[model samples]
Target chain A: MKERIKVALAQISCKQGDKAENIRKIEDNVIKAKQQGAELIIFPEFSLTGYTVRDCVYELAETIPGHSTTVLEKLAKKTGTYIVFGMPELSEKTQATIYNAAVLVGPDGFVGKYRKMYLPTHSVFEEKRYFRPGCKAGVFDTKLGKIGLIICYDIFFPEVSRLTRLKGAQLIVCISASPATRRTFFETLTAARAIENTAFLAYVNLVGIEDGLQFWGGSRLIAPNGKVLVKAKYDEEDLVIGEINYADIRPIEAFVPTLKDLRPELFDELREAAERL
Target chain B: MKLKPSVLDLKWTEVETKIRRFIKDYVEKSEAKGIVLGLSGGIDSCTVASLAALAIGGDKTLGLLLPEQETFTTKDVEHAELAAEKFGFKTEMIDITPTLKAFYDSTPIFKTTDKLCKGNIKARTRMIYVYYYANRLGMLVCGASDKSETMIGYFTKWGDVAADISPIMDLYKTQVRKLAQHIGLPKEIVTKQASPALWPGQLAEEELGIKYETLDLILYGLERFMKTEEIAQQLGAKKELINKIKLRWVSMEHKRRMPLTTKMQYRTVGADFRLPRTLH
Candidate 1:
């Protein structure tokens, strides 16, 4: 028998700059995901205060292990479910700096968080104005497996995923608030990441319209073999539960040989040469 | 050369699904009882009202037909009422001839020949009624302004363009026609000539000096930041025509945004001070 654990993708809409209401909605879905027997529940980018916060970052940004983490800690302790969600993190090293962060918490307490490495400044995204890009990727250990975290535009950068996988993360949860225009791009990139890394992926997205941007939510769980396990409806709030087995990817990783075939030694030289450009 | 279907085509089922969800989400978030829209019996409003009916149900969506004496026609009334019945929404017709007459009687320089000023009065008058119904019923007003008109400043400010939310505002005029057909609306309604009906026999294509098909393609090219010459080459159109459209598109920027003010404050409301309306 395989050791399987269910994962829930909570594809819900966030009220922009409203942390209290957004958390209330998140809490509701956390209970529902737990009721459906999901051991790990995930929410989309800026799930705490909503994306497109603009200058409200001054007011909405929360310190890690502060109000949001403490509340999530109580929920995680009660449900016995590990949760991953996004929030605007006010930096501890420097209070003036803020980073878009993907946070993780379990039954024990807040485990860790990965600040998003890429702050997309182009087109509809003005994240660069509000966030300072994170210096490193994060992979955290838990009872289920080593889980990794990535933000919306971070999925576009393959280096982040490779670094996380190289650090021994078997499952990567990409929390996004991607809009309608970028839907096709995210869909293609997600499956590609899972197949290349030979790792399980859970993509959770925000739904609903904020101003003129209609977030087309098509949240899904992808297998190591690039197969879709479950998908949520677009432009609507949905909680989709999918099962994952940590041991299932071991053989595929061995057969595919992606991790084994990587040549970091040669890549270091290539990076040094390309740096001149 | 005509633009390819691959360039402008849409999977209307997906479009319909997304739009219905937008309507539902907007109404839900605003905590409004239902949707209210001005029904001109043209393709845009008919299509919008149909989508609203599908989004929240016919009973909740109210379509108001505000026709005046100069532009009144039985065929349009039939079309408007038929659309209401077919699309499963209720309709109430009000003769705005008296309102226009009242303004015409009271105001100075209310020349009957000055169609532009009188026409604007009619458009603004229709909005007053629309907003009144919305206020009375606690329903959000859904504007039927399409993107093509919106981009080129074809809509009347604070009148036809005013609404709590405009679901079809993202779609171009030609795209809205395709959407109307896809949703299985009546051919008569879908193919009807669009008019603002502020004046008698006033067609949008005639006033704009460009057909919707060409206008949509030109707008599409311009929106992509294609050079006027490049847009002309692709569409097989004159560069002069393309430039004319481009100039209008640029000059009409004020209509698309809030009125500009001098940046005296640290953060200006319409300029650097940016925040989503939901937060307020």
Candidate 2:
């Protein structure tokens, strides 16, 4: 594994439900990031379509390893750059069901995807109405490093990132379409998640407004020690690049050992109590 | 004045940044050339003008100062011109007296004593001119209905309230005042008494029967779902007054929403069906 890899976060506003336009922009970002010597380029949640896609869910939903991934895979092959992006996945098992999924594509082809586990259905978010819950947290291995993937709301749950870290992932990528209202929560939690899991956390958030909702594009990358290495501009389109020193993970983990002090066995009683409730 | 609750004090810098982004993004999304808003020389409109100029350059922003004869004042025009000068947006002086006179002439039912009707006509006339510029120049109409007036249905519907987008409507009048000052609006504009200037000697506070300083807090309490009694107790105001404010807030609900439609179909537009953000 490489000791260091540069990652680029494409914090761009999306044209809602315009897949072709969005894909064109995504490909442009990938090329730019690749030219900047970034091995991996990250985009925000629903980068293929804007987040306020209530009625267009059925029309915009595509199959995994489907057209978007296929197009991205070819672009990956051409540029030799790995890309992670968010798209609505139509469930093959349950034809009518859809999932908010994060897709990973590289020089090899489609690697894997993580469906969002937490479907936030409160406030401005009605994800439960549109998407079925994702099955589990997942980690995909690439030439860069062992990488874990999560969506916007899943960052709230510590177990998601902890499980990925315990599964031997060094970096966690969270692609979000979070708005201005919940910015402080995401910012504080991203750093906390990295500190506890002792893994690099790169958060890429959507920019621009849709349907009266404004998104604050404060994409940031946090090191294992919860240090903010780089941050994007607020409320505007900005491409921010940061280096992921894989070598620092071990020393930070060895010194802090936050992940090593885990005691999941004790949570069985609390889990049982949750079932009782 | 007693110290207001801390909740009303927003971080102006953050608020301005977010609102600026919203204006700039909405302008881009609509693919419009610039923004066109009726500048009444009030705190609300001046606040919007300052922010719009900051969001998109002042060269792109257009402020129309529509002065009718009955309520027209040199001071209003001067204040508006000051705003245009401070923020680099261009200003146009449009005398709407001719349009109002035509409305009265065309309508046989027009009454000399009906100041309310005449005021509404003036407001609607200004909208036509503002929208005319918007259509001709490919710009979007930005409305300046602040939350205090909006919650109590103080605006003339389909008149001054009509807009392609409302940038400062979410803010209360007091909040708008603070924001206006923070955005570098002159003290004359920021401290000016709230008025629609539909007729001479007309004031919004006089018509609403309450001060914005108190009204914003009542609306804030109601927004939090606080009981009228609780709000009265907390704010040290009368229960009846709080109840009255709450009634105005709820009774004006129709003003804040689209006209109701009976739902017989599986889904109805403006009820369950809504346009996608991209389409808008």
Candidate 3:
């Protein structure tokens, strides 16, 4: 377990449903991140296929350990690094259903996969139309350490990150294809989640114009203390690199012990009262 | 990147072209024959008139002079004429005193017939004439009010504020003055003190209790989301005045929004169910 892990956030523009082109860009970025001496490289939500693919989600959905993962696995091995990205996944249990999934690949090949737990179905988002909610959340042990993954909209619910951290994840990677609206919320929420969980949080967001909504690419890396170590340029494609010290999380937790002070009995009682109401 | 409020600085030529194009496209989309506006000879009205003329053409623009007997000066009529003549737009004069007096005579309910009540009557009277011509010519009424007045709720409700389109609505008074000059409006109209001309000796600055210069700076600060003390310090003005402006802005929030409707149904008009006016 390394004390400090270098992570690179690749904020890239995605052409709608252009899998080949997006894959090429992802591969190129992996090589670039490797050159920059980053152990883990991250990409925005739907970096494999693209966001806003309404019905095309069916056509774009790929199976895990499938063609796209095979390519990404080779890229990770060749670059000697770990790669995490978002895509529409064909549910293994029920192949008919699609899930917004994030795949993690390292030098050892496929590490783990996380389907987005919360499917957003609101203004400008119709993910519920195409995706099934992920069943569970857990952590993946990489060479860097125990790392957790959650797609967009999952961060809105605190339980998602908390559960991941409880499952022994030291860092959480939140990949998003978020638009400019409510951008301040995303930024503040990422920091808030990091501080609350006493875990390192890295967010990579898509940039450029997509379906008339401008995606703000203010990707950031936040320490457990809610310190923003690096933030990428807004509305522009750029690589943001930051170092996460695994040792930093220990002292932070030792000082505050937010997780240690949890009262699950009270939380369960509150949940029961809320349900009754 | 951090958002710099300096991006709001006006480039006169680009602004002019954009507004003209916007008006032109709006008129075309609304399927209105042209535009009609009440010309008060104030900088706001003159600027709107110039833009309307540039938009739909002088032949399609109609300028109305609705002057109350006591409130309007001869210089007001002359300046309005100067703008109309320069733009080559047709003008008609409607004496609004009789209309105002009719309301006063019919409803003697007001215990006090003060300047405020009378000024509102004048504004609504002019509104009637502006709409009358607009209806006659199949035209939309273009309002000449600017952002500074609108923000403070200075204009009378359903009066000069009523419009099918407010072309200069986003520009502040100072910016409007700059635009009026840039469009080659006569110096008389561009340099004149802004007045609603609803009553005699009613200057907009005096009525609003803030000069357009100071108001614009404070507004710019507000636009950039600056704190009141920061704005006051940066502009070398009073913190009290900045706070007052902010209070006025908050109090006048209703004027900026559509009337609130109770949502008893799943979808209420302007509450849950909203479609662009241009949508079929």
Q: Which ranking of candidates, highest TM-score first?
A: 1, 2, 3
Task: Score each candidate by Cα lDDT.
Answer: 0.89, 0.89, 0.85
Residues B1-280, candidate 1: write the lDDT tens digits: 3454456788899899888988887788888999999998888888899999999999999999999889998888887788888879988989989988999999887898988778889999999999999999999999999999998888787889989989999899989999999997788988888888878989999998889889999998888888888888988889999999988889988888888899898999899897877663
Candidate 3: residue A203 lDDT (0-100): 95
lDDT per residue for candidate 3 within A1-277, as digits (tens), equals: 8879999999998767888999999988888888888999999999987787766677789899899999999999888999999999997677569989999999999999998999889877878877888978858987899999998789999989999999999899999999876688898899999999999999999986554456788999999999999999987899979999888998999888999999888888878988999
Q: Model 3: how many Å of interface RMSD?
A: 9.8
- Could you tell me the TM-score of candidate 3? 0.55
**For model 2 chain A, the run of ten residues with the poorest summed lDDT:** A258-267
Candidate 3 fnat reads 0.00
Model 1 has an lDDT value of 0.89
TM-score of chain A, every prediction, order shown: 0.97, 0.98, 0.97
Candidate 1 wrong stretches, greater than 4 Å: A1-4, A93-96, A265-277
Docking class of 3: incorrect
TM-score of 1: 0.93
Recovered share of real interface contacts in candidate 1: 0.64
